[model samples]
Target: MTPAELGIGIVGLGSIGTTHARALRQVDGVEVRAVSGGAPGTAAECGWPGAVRLTPEDVLSHPGVDVVAVCSPTASHAALGAAAVEAGRHVVVEKPLATTVAEARRLAELQHERGRLVTMVAQRRYEPDYAYLKELAVGGRLGELRLATTHVHWLRDDAYYAAAPWRASMTGGGGSLMNQGVHNVDLLRWLCGPVEEVTAQYATLGHGIEAEDTTVATLRFASGALGLVSTSTATPPGAPATVALHTSAGAVELGQGEVLRWNLPGVPPPPPDEAVASGAADPAAIGVAGHARMWREVVAAIRSGGGHDADAVDAVETVRLLCAIYEAARSGARVRPGELR
Candidate 1:
């Protein structure tokens, strides 16, 4: 390894972890030094023949590991992330941050205490199509956001869940919203603004899983914009997830990787990005370019001592919103994200 290379230690070797390893290969100046927690021989299967295999604890303490990527189950994210930051290693955790708002908040607090960088993987923020949309929406080119709606109607077969049982458990973050729709939820809030309140209803209409296979929610943005979110792993013959925005100026809708519709005046839309692929039918179909881009920016931030695109605090807020949706569904009340303890 070169002296300039940043060493990465992965805490899980499951699908997402393997994906991380593959994506990191596309990033310059970083190497997967070690990994822990997956079936035996998983490292070689992931094409990481040189990555040292060790226990999670050992991986954290390894002298060669400068960054720890926590790709474990949701229930383990809080503890693993805290341990990595406390060990003086920068961290990159997968989305939703944690299973609960309290856990996510505590991790964010610990990140502040340690002064170590902790970034959550919200890779859609790095996709060219979504990045362009964010510029237009956040830059006010869309003008005064009015309404935002996103739908994540994706299908997951019994075999898919059978392969990873955690994908079907609430504590494990196996729900449709947490597992599949989280990026879109994060994107919605990022593009529009904070969600002031949510009223939601969810059910396990299709799957036999403990968590809901389908969920629907109404959001009141702090910007006074109303929004709708519908996610389902039960929907068959799944189509690409979509985020449609209506503003004072006009309206635009984003497909998985391209702009589905554009009606805004005085502003030309970006050319379609054909490289983008949707995980609507198959999770593995989600390409690695976005993840590669995210890692590049994160590595740059770690080297420059600057901030990440999605920091721990920002990630906590997304979890806060997610918790509020569940809470609202249970209580039949208009729950605010901040009201979660």
Candidate 2:
């Protein structure tokens, strides 16, 4: 390996971990140095036959591992990410940060104290359409935001839950909101600004899971914009998740991969980027373009001492928003994300 090449060790070689490994192929100067926690020979099975399979602990301590990608279950994200940082490795964690706001906050604090680069996997932020949308919204091209909404109406069969018991438990960060809906939540919050309060209701309408399969919430953004969020694994024949932005100037809407509507009069919409893919109907169908883009940019940032698009600290806030929604549902009262921790 070249001296400048960065070494990556991945924990949890499941679909997500394997996804990370494959995404790294599009990144330059990075190689899978070690991995642990999945079916035996996952590294080879994922096409990285050269990567050594090791214990989770061994992967963290591997001399070649300059960075650790914590693709494990959501419940393990905080602990593994913290341990990796403590081991003097930059870390990457999947979304929602942790099962609770407290854990997410603690992990963020530890990352700061350790002075390591930690990024959360909210890959949708890297999508060409989504990225351009953010640019336009933040640039004020969308005019003063009046309302922003997102819906992640997707389905998960019993087999999906059976394949991973943890996915059905709250402690494991299961449920549609956290597991499948977080990326949309992240996008919603990113576009609409901080949420001042939330009122929500949730129920387990499908798949006898321990966590709610459906949740609906109304948000009040600090910008005085009203927002709506609906997520469900109970919905049949899932379709692409969508987000719409309404402003004084006009309105715009985008599905997971395609633009649904672009009403801004003088502002032309972004050119269609055919590379986008969605896991609306089938989780396995999620494309790697977003992950690959994120990996490339993150590696470049690490090399140049620049900042990453998805900061661990910001991701913690996203978790706080989710926590607030759940709290509102349980208490039947408006909850503020800022007041979470």
- Residue-pair clashes per prediction, in order, are 0, 0
- Please provide, for model 2 over 179-298, each residue's C-alpha lDDT reduced to its tens digit, 9 standing for 90 to 100: 998999999998888999999999999788899999999999999999999999999999899999999999999987798999999998887778887788789788778888888887
**Segments in model 1 whose C-alpha atoms lie over 4 Å from true places:** 1-3, 39-41
The per-prediction CA RMSD against the true structure, in angstroms, equals 1.6, 1.4
What TM-scores do the predictions have? 0.97, 0.97
TM-score of 2: 0.97
Q: List the residue pairs that clash in candidate 2.
A: none
Question: Cα lDDT of all candidates, in order?
Answer: 0.89, 0.88
Predicted candidate 1 versus true structure: per-residue lDDT over 16-61, tens digit per residue: 8988988998999988989997877887776677889999999999
Residue-pair clashes, model 2 = 0
